[model samples]
Target: MRRPSLNDLAAFAAVANHRSFRRAADVMGVSRSALSHAIIGLEGKLGVRLFNRTTRSLSLTQAGATLLARLDPVLQDLDRALDTLSEERGTPSGTLRINANKSGARILLANVVPRFLDLYPDVELDLVSEGRLVDIVEQGFDAGVRLLEAVPQDMVAVKFGGDVRFLAVAAPSYLEGIVPPTTPDDLQAYRCIRQRLPSGKRYRWEFAKRGAEIAVDVPGNLTLDDNDLLVQAAADGRGIAYVPEPFAEPLLKTGQLVTILDDWCPPMPGLALYFPRSRHVASPLRAFIDLLKRWDGAR
Candidate 1:
């Protein structure tokens, strides 16, 4: 049997980790056709099939899974060794992938991302913004940004920004004839612009004040997934929207939206950058975290 090169094994691992030729190729900065051919060549050399391909889905065969289980750690160790060399030279150079929700992404881009990029021009930052929470290790992300409360307990979290508050707001026009909600339960009589979570369930509006807590499965005819959209819908007089304070600040300042049940909403823990406790932190990620801490401190 012919021996496969390091690149071949690395390519196989990339494909196996992502389970998508396109995504793997994108991460490796190679064309899909080239990546596919490399995997084919790798399978031929190894005399075993690595992936079970279909028109709609791609999954690893048992043999492929076995190879990946062993190869992933070796590749990770190799990467750590290479990173160590770069660290010795006092320069961090590599891709740092972060999975973040939209709010967290915006905050980072506005505050931390610029300085981090400027300081380490050799490092590439791949920041993906989405609503869903993903496994950073499984998805090949260097780290993940999410609310501190939502971060997995097993991961090490770096809290930043500050406390965040969710506000229940509505357009003055919508509230003209209706009495504003004095408490969480009063929302039942009003139209709410309900938020649909990434998990495909309606988000229950949570409120707390003076040792009392409530979760309201807000009633509404319209449901939206994105925060910006929900704010817009509320501003357009559709219904009340519960959104992050930042999202509604502009409209609140302009008097387009008025806060209701203000006493019930209090500040909660803010965004955090989290990573797996077990994996070796790469130099680039370590550098990024250092910058994040400094930026948060200076703010």
Candidate 2:
């Protein structure tokens, strides 16, 4: 077996990533025809089709996905190493990618990121909102938000946002004539609006009563992925919503909603900023970590 050159790998990665020969060539500062020829030459050498190209769109073949899955990390490490070398001369200025849930990002905006951007205006934040667990390192994210329990054992988890608790609430009008459940068991009788997870599963409402924590896959009339929509549905008397306390607390206080199942919810882990501790931190990640730490202290 022969080893591929840097040019071959770079060409392959760029083409696979952009999924467009023209875009890859533009980014690589080469003519489209030249880039195509290089890719053709590399493919002949490797003897595998890396891409499934059509007149309008390009898609990665199975072989291409496999190679890309392996190479993306290697390229990121190289980029990070290059950045570290550059850091010897001055402050870091580059993109820092993160994947977080919607509520987590709201907390960051409310309490963390403003100060971070104020401290370093040149640094860029490419934040993605996603609820499902993602392979941050493989997905090219520098870091991600996760619950303390959800965070991997090896990653360093910094508490950026304080603990989260679930709230079960319903509108005062909705509760009219209907006696609010005095106990967790009574919740089984009520219609609920629930969060539907990415896996097409309705989120079970979790509660704590006395010393026991119970997870109930309660029945719901309306199920959706959007947390805000769930809240709206609850407000419209569609059903009770089991949502993060941060969102429902304000409404509960205002009497727009009444809280139930308080004893069932123990404070769960807060929004955690975590990344692999073993890998060398890029300057952007280091600065972001510092920002989170500082923000945590102030909170």
Candidate 3:
């Protein structure tokens, strides 16, 4: 028997969490064989088989599951402690991981990220753009960016972007044979492009006017999970799309798309940055939030 190294434990945790040697290896930036060897060595030291493997799938053994349940939190705590120490040493430094949807990422790319990096060279930014609403604390993210309504009520929220409006738009070719929609209900008669959310439900187009809000589940032949793809479909004459103004701007300018039911659409709370209120904020993360507030004020 021998002492298990921290590297071996980390490798084991990654593999256990992902249940795929290939995926874990990719995350660790190491070869599959190297990760396998590390895990094998770790198992030998512990004198227990950590995983059951078949060609199609991998599952953790009881010992492995117990180890993972305990190890993950310890590693997370260790990482947080180290980050805290880094903050105390003069300037803010260490990785600041953010989880954001595509639109939120777009806002950060356009305004905050580049400038923040220049302002705090010691901070490392890890931005993950996805279509899911992640639990920032559970996922070990410094913060997450999401639409205002999507943010959890338990978290601290900050405005990150300007108020945004959804526009029902279509290419001229798609609208040629059809009467334009003058109201939200009129959308039901048109071939609308719809968005499929990460929660496995279709996103009903939302519109508001004069203290009234309307959600329309317009029928369409196409539905997609990606916002960019939905906008592209509209530009290509597939169908009319209900999308944020920013995504449809270029096409509007180029005359590839024309808006309908503009009077029905009103601005909603835009993208917001949020984090668990109970957690201690890292210096880099705090500084980033301050920067966002300053930018919000400036705009």
Judging by TM-score against the true structure, name the best candidate: 1
Q: Global lDDT of each model?
A: 0.94, 0.80, 0.87
TM-score ranking from best candidate downward:
1, 2, 3
Model 1: lowest-lDDT 10 consecutive positions: 133-142
User: Residue 193 in candidate 3 has what lDDT?
Assistant: 85
Which pairs clash in the backbone of model 1?
none
Q: How close is candidate 3 to the true structure, as a TM-score?
A: 0.77
Any runs in candidate 1 off by more than 4 Å, and if so which? 54-57
Once fitted onto the true fold, the runs of candidate 2 whose alpha carbons sit more than 4 angstroms away are 1-8, 11-41, 44-77
Residue-level lDDT tens digits of model 3 in 1-299: 79999999999988887778987786677999999999999999999999999999899999999999899888878777877787677678877889998888998888888889998999889999998887665465779999899999999999867899988888999889767878888877778888998999999888888988888888988998886788899989999888889999998999999998888988888989999886667788988999889988898
Predicted model with the maximum lDDT: 1
Tens-digit lDDT track of model 1 for 1-299: 89999999999998888888988888889999999999999999999999999999999999999999999899989988999999898899989999999999999999989999988999999999999999776677889999999999999999999999999999999999777889999899999999889999999999999989999998899999999999999999999999999999999999999999999999999999999998899999999999999989998
Supply the global lDDT for candidate 2. 0.80
Better of 2 and 3 by TM-score: 2
For each candidate in turn, the TM-score is: 0.92, 0.78, 0.77
Cα deviation in Å at residue 95, candidate 3?
3.6
Error of 1 at 72 (Å): 2.2
